[model samples]
Target: MAELQIAEIPYEDGGIRYRYARRLSEDGTRWIRDGRFTAYHPNGAIASEGTYSDGIEQGLWRDYHDNGRIAAEGQYDRGQESGVWRYWDSDGRDVNG
Candidate 1:
């Protein structure tokens, strides 16, 4: 199996930033973003966490508010959302129904 390779640089835009890492194809022609990923708010606090496979988002994912509170949680299947999803307020109250 190929080992995961991190992006050469971090992505930043609109006060958000994140990094992506993935494995390189045997031909080295394509760099896929696989493994763990995280995004941060402008204040440098973590805004989200998730996993990806073959360049597509997968598995459990969590997004947080700028104040360090979880804003949402759910599962993903190859970048498509799957299973139950929940949302929370900045105060940490579950608002998902």
Candidate 2:
């Protein structure tokens, strides 16, 4: 794993923007903010992910779908969802939308 840092990266296949990425942690480790993350696709589409701090979902958070919809999302709060949370279906569609 690489050290955490704030930097911009390209999508997994260089299709879109992937910013602020950090190394994935161990199973027991919690996601924290050092300004790092990634956005990718399972089949093909957008998916963002990351961590967050100060009640904000920060770092490496991703959102998108394999069918060009919304698949799901990412979290790193070390706790439950709070303050401005969103949900999506398996196809990456927003539930609230």
Candidate 3:
């Protein structure tokens, strides 16, 4: 097995900053996401966080609003959303309630 490496990439769109950091492993051909994944919003707040397996999303995932509030959270299976999902408004109010 190839040693896993973590990479952090920063992006700018219309003067807004964004970041994507993830664990990657070489699959004998190319690098693939294989562990924790995190994305930051333009304001440097966590936009989303999750785990990846073999380049696919797996397990629980959470998304947050720019104000540092939880926006949504749910489970993922093989990169597809699965099971129950809960959402909240930007003000942190539960949207499903």
C-alpha lDDT score of every prediction, in listed order: 0.85, 0.53, 0.80
Query: Tens digit of lDDT per residue, candidate 3, span 1-97?
Result: 6677777776655432433334434446667787888888877888898888888989999999989999999999998999999999999899886
| Cα deviation of 45, candidate 1, in Å | 0.7
Spell out the clash pairs found in candidate 3. Answer: none
Candidate 3 residue 79 Cα shift, in angstroms, is 1.5
Judged by lDDT relative to the true structure, which candidate is superior, 1 or 2? Answer: 1
Q: Which whole-number lDDT from 0 to 100 does residue 92 have in model 3?
A: 89
What lDDT score is found at residue 38 in candidate 3? 85
Q: Of the candidates shown, which would achieve the greatest TM-score relative to the real structure?
A: 3
Q: Give the worst 10-residue stretch by lDDT in candidate 3.
A: 15-24
Native-to-model Cα distance after best TM-score fit, residue 6 in candidate 1, in Å: 2.5
Cα error, candidate 2, residue 78 (Å): 5.9
Better of 1 and 3 by TM-score: 3
The regions of model 3 sitting more than 4 angstroms off are 13-27
Put the candidates in TM-score order, highest first: 3, 1, 2
List where candidate 2 sits over 4 angstroms from the true fold. 1-20, 23-33, 51-62, 71-79, 90-97
